[model samples]
Target: MLNERISAAKQIASELHAAQEAIDEVMIRIARLAGTLPAARRDTNMSAIVGQDAMAKVAQALAASGDVRQLLTDAHLALTATQKQVGLGTRMFGAGVKPPSAMFADEGSNDRGVVTALAQAS
Candidate 1:
């Protein structure tokens, strides 16, 4: 049983790692696209088309990777379980943790509800 559990854990980790790798690749591509966005928006350059093309490619890549969906589902389940255990905020968007825009919004606050509301709006 222990071995089976270990094996399952390892598989989950591997799948999640591959998904993260895909996400990292997508992020890098998106970053490059973002860098080009400003210049593209300013001028009718070929880079604008290229940026859109790159974004489409990234989206395609993500869509093609089934492990990405599985990994996200796994993460959602884990987070949900964690939230239940902690008896805290909703797990819809990673509640009970530091938000990325928290620094811009406020200091010394765990207002996940607010964060969640803003995120949903976006």
Candidate 2:
């Protein structure tokens, strides 16, 4: 029973990891599509304006990237920790082990990959 629960937890973690990886890949693809700004002009004043605008765009992109990065990091941490907790819970529950609860907290949260993965894992 313990082994089964641990297996289940690890399975869920793997699925979540995969889903996050897919999302990250998509974000990267989109960012690449957006592309970087062209080089600034040689004129100091004109270059300054261009540079400022470019910096603004870069800052916006960085902000967006930071949010996505945070989400991805959170997903990774949640997956690893949840897997460990589920494994521990399995041992604690012993003969009639119960599955981890938090795993279902984000159920139907518009993440098809996640939902599918959870279904497959469970």
Candidate 3:
């Protein structure tokens, strides 16, 4: 029974990690696209084609994605607690409890500066 549970714990941790990663990736991409919308609208030929509200819409998505990422991060913390409860210990998953932004900042491996850029863009 203990072995089965340990295996399950590993699987859950992997899934949670993947979920965090997917959200981060999408948020970064959306924010990048949001950053470009204004430039796209500035082209005289493109201005006629780009909706005035396009930038606002993309920014909204980026912000909402951040919220989603936060929720997932919180879930990760909760899962860590459960891991401890089940005697899997703190080292069962990640090395430490760093938030996604700081852990993956500036390396372009995660959604670190993307949120701030989104806020400033607003």
Candidate 4:
């Protein structure tokens, strides 16, 4: 049962990551479309003026995508915390984390990786 639950958690995490990536890709595509559209430098006609104003909608879409990004990030963070609570430790899934070579690492290894590696070694 425990093994099944862990497996399920792993699958959920994977799916969550995939969903986040898909949303990001969509935002990128929209942004590229926005760039591809010809700029309306002069509002000489209704079409040009509308084109200029349409960018506001594009900007709103980008802003909405940003909100979605935050939601995905929050979900990821919550899953990480859940992993820690379930005795999964601080190791990143499918990634190796090593402590800094420095004797003391508060300042040295903040970027090195998770400190759990050091704790487990000693």
Which of the numbered candidates is closest to the native, going by highest TM-score?
3
Cα lDDT over the full model 3 = 0.71
| Deviating ranges (above 4 Å) for candidate 2 | 36-66, 88-122
Give stretches of model 1 more than 4 Å off: 40-122
Candidate 4 global CA lDDT score = 0.65
TM-score comparison, 2 vs 3, better candidate: 3
Model 3 C-alpha lDDT per residue in residues 15-68, reported as the tens digit of each score: 888888899899889978976777667754574457767777888899999999
lDDT of 4 by residue, 1-122 (tens): 66876787778867886888799898998897677554433324346555666777887888899899999877777776676677654444432332344222233335445555656678
The Cα error of candidate 3 at residue 58, in Å, is 0.9
Task: Give lDDT tens digits, candidate 2, residues 29-49.
Answer: 656644544333442335546
Q: Rank the candidates by TM-score, best first.
A: 3, 4, 2, 1
The local lDDT score (0 to 100) that residue 78 gets in candidate 3 is: 75
Local distance difference test, each candidate: 0.54, 0.55, 0.71, 0.65
Give the range of the ten consecutive residues with the poorest summed lDDT in model 3: 101-110
Native-to-model Cα distance after best TM-score fit, residue 112 in candidate 4, in Å? 7.8
Best by lDDT: 3
